[model samples]
Target chain A: MHYTEQSHTFRKIIMTKRITLADVAADAGVSAKTVSDVIHHRGRMREETRERVRNSMRALGYTTNLAARTLRTGSAKLIGLAIPNFAQPFNGNYADIVTSYAWAKGYRVSITTYHRLSQGLRELSADAYRFGVDGWIFLTDTPIPAQDNFLNQDRPVVLTGDYLSHGVADTIMFPNVEASQTATTRLFELGCERIGFIGAPANADSLDVTTQQLDAALTAQEGNSAMRLRGHLTALLQHNRSPLPSLVGACTRLDRSDGEKATLRLLDAGAQFDALFCANDAVALGAMSALTSRGLRIPEDVQIIGFDNTPDAAFSSPRLTTIDPFTEQYAQMAVDCLISRLEGDETAPTVHITDFALIERDSTRH
Target chain B: MHYTEQSHTFRKIIMTKRITLADVAADAGVSAKTVSDVIHHRGRMREETRERVRNSMRALGYTTNLAARTLRTGSAKLIGLAIPNFAQPFNGNYADIVTSYAWAKGYRVSITTYHRLSQGLRELSADAYRFGVDGWIFLTDTPIPAQDNFLNQDRPVVLTGDYLSHGVADTIMFPNVEASQTATTRLFELGCERIGFIGAPANADSLDVTTQQLDAALTAQEGNSAMRLRGHLTALLQHNRSPLPSLVGACTRLDRSDGEKATLRLLDAGAQFDALFCANDAVALGAMSALTSRGLRIPEDVQIIGFDNTPDAAFSSPRLTTIDPFTEQYAQMAVDCLISRLEGDETAPTVHITDFALIERDSTRH
Candidate 1:
C-alpha cells in the first residue's frame, strides 16, 4: 500500500479535521441530537434511523474520544495489577490469565512490576494511584501495614498471594499450610521415611516456633516460606516422624539455582533422606537436577515433591510431583471480588480462600 | 490500615471534591498560572517557591489528571502492547521485559492479548485505538496486510516477530533464517550425516520454493515456521548435504506435546537420523523427553538443538543447546523505535534486524 506524497498530505489534512457526531449526522441526513442519542443509547429511536447513523459513523471513521468520555464519567474502565516481578514464571502466567479474564469483563489492564524487593508493597500502592485505574489487584509477598491509607483511599483493592491484613482490601489467600501437609502426608503414604525439606533456609529460626504458636499468631504476619515449613513440621509430627535439622535445607531464594545449592549442601553434609519436599516447582526442578547429577535414581532412591505446578513441571524429566495452587480459580475469584466492589458492593472486606491439590507424576511412586 | 466507618465516609467526601490547580494554588498561596507553570516546568522558578508548592500539593493530595492532560496535549504517555497469547511462555517473558523497560522510560503499559488466533491482527488494530495509547507495539505471528489502514492511521507502530512489510510500521524481525542455518551447520560440523528438523512441518511444500525466490518474494507473506525451514534447507545445501523428506517432522503447534507427538511419529516411521533441530525450546524439550523415553541417549545417539533460550532451556535434563533470539534486546529495540517515532521522528519506516547466538549446553557434545 504505497501512498504518494500528495495522498499522504491529503490524508493528513483529513485527519486534522476530527470526525465528529455532527459530521456523521450530516452524512446520514439526521439531526446531531439524534446521533448523540444513538451514541449514548438513550431515549427511543427508529431501528432504521439508528442503523443508518451507525453506518454513517463507521463510514466517516468516527471513534468516540475516550479522553473526553473518561473526563465526563470519571471512569477509565481500567484495572491496575501490581506484582513484585514478572520474571518469575508463576507471576507471568498469573498476569496473563488475569488480563485475559479482565478483558472479557470490559476492562483493560495496566501492569506494573516492583523490581526492588525491599520496596514492593509501598511502590505498588504509589504506582496504583499514578496509573489511575478504576480498581486494583495487588500481589505481594511482604506484609502490608493495616493502616496504609494510600491503598484504601478511593477505589476497590484486592490483595493476593501472601496473606495481608489491610483494612479495606479483600484478600485471596493461597492454602499453603493445608497443601504442604497434604504433600508431606502423601510422601509418608508412599513408604518414605526421613523426608528432607528444602525451602527458605534463611527463616529456620522462625520455622522453629511450634506449629501451635504459629497458628495462634496472625498467620498473615508470617511469610510464605514460614507457612510451608510449619505445614511440613505438622505433618511430620502427625506421622510419628521427627524432622532432623540435617534433613532440612534452607535457601535464601526459592529458585532453581538456590534449590540446587541447598540440596547439594544437605548431601555434602552427609544428610540421608528418602524423600524431599521443596518450596515450589522451580526448587523441585533444581533439586531433581542435583539429585540426578549425584547418580541417584528418582522414586527408587528418593521421592521428591514441589509446589505451584507450573507448566514446566509436566515436561521435566520424570515429570514432577507438585501442588497445584489453582491459579486460574484464584485469578477469577480476585477479579470477581474487585468487580463486585466496583459495582457498589459495600460489604466488609472478605477473605477468599482458594483450594489446592497434589498432582502425582513420575517423581513419586504410588 | 483499619478505617473507621466515619473515616471512610470522610475520605469519600474528600475524594468527591476533585483537587484542581486552583485548589493547589490557594493552598500554596500562589496564583493559578504560577501553579500551572510549576506543574509543567515551563519556566524558571525560585527553588524555595518550587519546594513550597510541591509540599503544598502533596499535603493537598493533588495528582495530575491524566485524562485532561491527554485531551490537551494529544499524548497519553501510555503504550499499548498487543500479543497473541500470554499463556505461551515466550510471549509472557517478552511482555515482562518490555513492560519493565517502558516503565523505566516513564511510560505506563496497557496490555491486551488476542485469544482467538484467527482474528489477531485485525482485532489488535481495533483494540489499540480503543485503549488510546500514545503509541503501539504489536507482536504477531500472522501475516498482516501491507496496506492495513487501521494500523497506519495516526500513530506510530512497530511490528515484532516474523518479517513484515507494512508500509508505515517499523519492523524488528527475529534472525530466524540465519539462526536456523547456524544450528543446522553445527549439527553437520559434529559429523552427523542425517539430521532431522522438527518444526512447523506444514511448511514442507513452501520449503521447496528455493531461497532466492523466497527472499525476493514478500518475506512477510511467509510465516515464521516456513522461514526457519528455508534456513535449515539452505544450510544443508551449503554443506553439500541433501535433506531427506523422511527426516523431517512437521508439527501443528510449537508446544511440547506436539513436539513429542511429531518426534514419535518420525521414530515410529523408522526414520534414520543422528541429529535433530527443533523450532523452539518447548518443542526441543518435548523431543528430548520423547527420545529419552524411547531409550535413546542424547549426544551419543542423537544430538539435538532448539531455538529461543527460555529459562526452562537451561534447566531441562540435558540443559538444552539452543539459539538465543535476544528477546530482551528485541523488546528494547521495538520500544525504542516506537518511542523515537512518538518523539517526532518522521523518517521512512525502518527494518531493524536483531542478532542470534547458539548457546552450547549438554544437549550437544562440545
Candidate 2:
C-alpha cells in the first residue's frame, strides 16, 4: 500500500501552508482518519497503510496540533457533569468521585449546577452544541422527560441518580427502595416497634400526609421520596404493624433544617416513636438536633439511621448509622459508560444499579 | 450609511459561498471586529459604520455561525476551578457560590480537584491550552511558589484559600488570625477562661508541641492551622494568661475525627479547660462529641466555638457557634478577578481579605 506519489510537488505546495492531516492523507492516498490513526497509534489500520501515512507526514513536515484538532473537529475530550449545588453532602461527595473517575478515563470534567426549578434537560438541548463537551453525565433529581427527547442531544448522555431514565440513556442508580427497606427492617429487628420516617415527600412544607396521599405518591413512584416511603411502609406492614400519620414526618425538601422541622412537627403531634429513618444524612443530623433539644438521647432513648454515608455522617454525634450507597462505584460506572459512548460504542442503553451496605454506628444498636 | 458596492457582483459572488463575517466585513470596508460589534449590539462604533455592516450582512445573506466563530477563535467562555474534594464543607460552599457567580457573568465553569500532594499550578501551565478554559481560579492549600512563575499561566489565575499567593495572582482570603482571635475573645467576654485550642499543626499525629514549636509555626504563618493556633494563644496572652501546654490539643489535620482524637489526648493529659476554640466546624463537631461522651455539658460547663459556619454547625446539638468567613463574598471576588483578567484587564495582582462574623448559638452563652 506504499504510495508512489511525487513528493516534490506536495513539498513545494506545503512550503507556503501549514501541513495538516488532510495534506498528509492526500499525499498517502488514504482517508484523514487513517492519517489520524497513524499519528495517535489508535484504531485498526493496515501496517502498510500506517507506514505510508507516516512517510507522507514526514515528507509533508506535518505536526499535529492538539488544540487545532479539538477546535476544528469540535471533539474536546471533555465530559460535562450536571449536579445539584454542593450544600448537600451527597451532591459534593458524588461530584468529587465523578471528577476522579472522569480524569482516570482520560476526560476532563466540566461541572455545572442543574437547578431543577429553573431549568431542565429539555432546555439544555437548545444550546448543547455551544458547551463543546463530548458527552454529558447528569445527576438529576427529576426523571428526564422522554417525550421531549431530552436525551437526544448532539452528544451522548449517561445519567446517575435515583430517577427513571425512560430507557433513553445509560443510567446509574442505587436501590433506593431496597436500601430503605433494609434500614427499616434493621430498626424493627432492634425491637423498635414505632419507627418514624423523616423527609417523606409532602404536598407542602411540614404537612401531615394522609394515607390517600401516600397511596397516590406510591402509585406514581416518580422519585426517591416515594420509593423510600414505600420501603418504610412495606417494612412496617411485613411486621404486622400499620404506619401512623403522625410518625411519618413529611418535608418538601431533604435538608438538615427540613429534617429538624419534620421531627418537631412529629413531636408536637405527640407521635411516640423509638426510631427514625431519614432520607439522607443531612436530614438525619437535623433529627438528632431536634431529639437532643427535647432531652431524648440517641440509641438509648431513640435510634436514628441516615442514608449516603457522607463524611458528615462519620463525625455526627453518635456517628450516624447510614447506608453507604457506593458512590465511588456509581461514579465509575457513569464515567465509563459516557467514555465508551464517546469512543463509538453503540451498545443498548443499560441501567447500572450499585450495591449498598448498612454502616452500623452509635446512632443504632448492634 | 449603507455600503455603495457593486450589488449584483457581490450578491453573485456570495451566492455560492456561505457568507462569513469576513465576507461581510470586506463588503462594508471594515474590520471583522466591527462586524462582530454590529451583530452583538456592543462596543463603541459610529452609527454609520453599524448601518453599513448590517446592510452588508443583509445583502450578502450572512447568517451568524456562532459555533464556527468559537471553534476557529478558540474562545469557549469557560472558567476552570481547581479545588480540593468536597468532603470539606468550605470547599463545597465556595464551589457552589463560584458556579452561581460565574454563570451570572456569562461563563460556564469547569471544575477539577487540585491535590497539593500530587500536582501544583506550575504543572497545569504545561497543558493549559488543551482544557479550553479562558482563565482559572485555584482553591489551594499550598501557597504557589514565587520562583516557578506559576501565576504566568496562559490563562489568568486567581486563588482562594488560606495560603499566600507570593503576590503572583489575585488571591481571596479570610482573616484567619483575626477571626480566630475574635471567636476566642467572644468566649472570654461571656465569662469563660482556660480556653483550649484543638487542631494545631503537630509535626506528627498526636505529637505534643512545645512553646518553641508554637513560636516557630507562628513565625512561618503558613496555613489555617498555624494561623488559628496563633489567634488562640494571642487571645489568652491578651487576657494576661499563659496557655498551658497540656490544655492545647494537637492534630495534623482539621477533620472531625482529628478533633475528637485531639480532645481525647488533652483529656488524657488531665488538662482542665472550661472552653475550647476549634479550627473548623468539623473539628468543633468532633470536639462536641468528645465532650458529650465524657459527660461535659456544652455552655453550662465547657462552652465551645468553631470556625467556618458550615451547615453542620447550624444543626449540631447545642447548635455550634462559629465564625462565618463570608464564603459568598470570597467566591464572588475570586470569580470576578478571574473574569476581569480573562476580559483583558491588566491590573497588578492584589490580595482580597474578606470580613468575618462570630455567630452566636447554643454552643456559647448570649
Candidate 3:
C-alpha cells in the first residue's frame, strides 16, 4: 500500500491493513486482554508492561476504534451542547464556560447552534444522537415539551434558560423574574417612577404560565419576556405604582439593534417613563446608544438597568448596571447534573433554580 | 433475557444477544448487502427499501459502528479548532463563526482553547490526532515554527490571526499592520497628532520581523502587538510625525481591564497624547471606560479608534469608531481553505490577506 507522508512532525502512516489489538499484543509480547485493559485503563498493569504496550501502539500508529468500544460500553465520552444562537455575547460566554468545565471533567463537547427556535429541541436531540453523544446540555429560550422522546428516554439531558418545561430532563432554571424585580426595585430606590421595559412581549398578560401545559407551549419570547415583565410589574406594584402598558416596548429579539429600535418606538409613541429596564445587557447597550444619541443622560434623564452581566456590560459607556444571573454557576450546575446522570445516578429529574445578584455599575448610580 | 426499565419515556432494553446486520436484513426483507448499502448511504437503493431498512434498524436498535467504518475509510469527518483563549470576545466570536461554517459544510468541529500561548501548537496537534480530526483551523497569536511537523506532513491546517508564520499550513492573515496604519491615519486626519497606543509591547524594536526566521522566532506579543505597532508607526512616519515612545501604553493582554490599566499607566507616567488607537475592540472599550471615568470626553478630549469592530463596538456608549478587520470574511476564507484541502485540493499552500474597512462612529468623529 502506498501511503503519502503528511507534512507534520508525526508521520501519519496510512495503512492498507488494519492494526488490530492482537497485532499490538504480539508486538508487546502480551495477551490481547492485557492490551485491552491498557487501552481501556481498566485493570492495573505493571508500569514497564504498560509502557511497552503504549510504545508498541505508538510504533504501529494504532488508533482506538471508538465506535466499536461505544457499541460494547454504550459510552462515547462526548457531550452535545445545543444553544439557540451564538450571536449573543451571553450565549457565547456561557458556551465557553461550559466547554471549559466539561473539558476539565475529561469530556469533549460538540456545540450545535439551532438557528430556528421552534425546531431547537428536535434538532438538538437528533444531532446529539447522530454524533453519538452520551449526554446533552440544551440551552434554549423556548420551552421544551415533556413528551420529547429523546429528552424523556434515550439519553440524559440537562435543560437551562428562561424556558419553563423540563421535558422529562433535569433543568437548571435562570431566575429571570427575581432578577428583573430586583433591578426594577433598585431603579425605584434611585427615585425613578414610570419605568420603561424593553425586550418584553406586546401583551403583559402572556407572561403568566399558570399551568405546566401552557408552560410547555410557551414561545421563547413569551417565556423570557413574560418572566421579566412579571418581575418589573411586581416591583412597580410593591412601590404603589401601577404597571403602565404604554411604557412596555415589544422586541422580537434580544439584540442591541432590537433594543435600539424598541427604545426609538417607545420615544416615538410618546411613552412617558423616568427609567428603563432592558431584558438583557445587549438590549441595555442598544437602549443606552439610542438614549445617548437622543441627548438623554443615563441615570440623570432615565436610569437604565439590564440583565445578564455579559463582559460588555462592564465595559460599556456608563458601564451598564445589570443583573448577574450566575451564568457560570448555572453552566456548572447543568454540567454536574448531566455528568451525575451519565455516572449511573437513577434519581428523579431535578430542577435547580440559580441565584442572582444585581451588579450595580455607573448606568444606574445616583 | 430480563431487561431493566429505564426512568425515561423510551424504555431502554438491555439485550442479552447482540443484533447484527443479518437480523436487520431479515426483518426488513432485504439482502444483507442491501442493508449495508443503505446504512452507508451508498450503492443506490430505492426510497421505499431505504425507509424499510432504516425502520428495521431503528426497531432493532442498530447503531452504526463509526469506529469500525473509520478504520476502513480513514476519515472521521471532523475538524478541530484551536484558539488561544475564549475569555476574549474576539476568540469566542471567531470560534462561533468557524463552527457554524464548518457545520454548514457537513463537518463537525471540536473546539480546544489553548490556555498557554507557548504550548499551543504542540497541544493542538496532539488533541486533533487523538480525536481523529480530518483537519484543523488554528487561531493563535504565537508565531508557529516554519518546520512544524504537524503543518508540514500530517493533516491540513489553516492558520489565522496577526501571526506571520504559516509553517506547512495555509495562512489567512488579518492585515493587522494595514488596519492599524489606516486607524492611526484616520486619527491624524481628525487633526490629532500625538496618538497613544494601548495593547502594544513596551519595546518598539521587537516590531521588526523582517525575515522568515525572525518571524518564526517572534513571541506572541511581537506577532500581534508589534505588527500593530509597526502599522501605527508607519502611518505616523508617513505624515512626517515621529513616533513618541512615551505615549505608547504597553498591555500584557488584549482585554478590557488590561486596556483600562494600560491607559491609567500612561496617564500616571505623564505621557501626553491627544488621540488613542487600541489594538482591539475589547481594549478600546476598556480605554473608553477609563477615559470617561477621568471626565474626558470621547472625540472632544481624546479621539479613539479600535480594531475588530466586535459587536460591542456598535453598542458601546459613544459607539466606538473601529477598523472592521472583516472577521466573518476571514472566518469564511479559513473554512473554505480547510474544506478545499479536505476535498483533496493539494495545490501549493495559499496565503489570504484579508481586507479591512474603517467604521467611523461617534468615538473618533469630530
lDDT per residue as tens, model 1, B1-366: 223223322232224356788887887788888877776656677977776676555444565453455456667677888777655568777877888888778776766666642345554453443466777888876676654444565667788877575566788887888888899999999888888888753554542223344343224335667677778877878988766667777776687887888888889989888999998888899899899889998988999999989877888898899999899899999999989999999999988878989999999999
TM-score of chain B of each: 0.81, 0.79, 0.83
Ranking by lDDT: 2, 1, 3
Task: Put down candidate 2 lDDT per residue, B1-366, tens digits, no spaces.
Answer: 355443322232114445678988898899999888876668998888888887676555453354445555657687888776676777777777888888888887767665421344444443444455667888776655555455554457897777777776788888898998898888899898788889888775447878777666556565888888888788888999876777777776577888898998888888899999998998898999899889899989999999989878888878999999998888899998988888889888999989999999999987
Every prediction: chain A TM-score: 0.81, 0.80, 0.83
Give lDDT per model, in order.
0.74, 0.77, 0.73
| Model 2 docking tier (incorrect/acceptable/medium/high) | incorrect
Model 3, A1-366: lDDT tens digits are 111123223443334465789988897889999989887768888888887886666555454453455545777577777776667788878877888888788776766666632344654453343455687888877665544434553667788876644437788877877788899999988888689888875433542122332232222333666788778777877898756656777677778998998898888878878899998888888899889888889878998999988988888878889999999899999999999999999888877878999988888875
How many clashing pairs in candidate 2? Answer: 0
lDDT of 2 by residue, A31-58 (tens): 9988787766689977888888866764
Provide the lowest-lDDT 10-residue window in model 2 chain A.
Answer: A5-14
Worst 10 residues of 3 chain B by lDDT: B1-10
**DockQ values of all predictions:** 0.31, 0.18, 0.23
Q: Against the true structure, what is each candidate's TM-score?
A: 0.86, 0.80, 0.84
lDDT score of residue A352 within candidate 2: 87
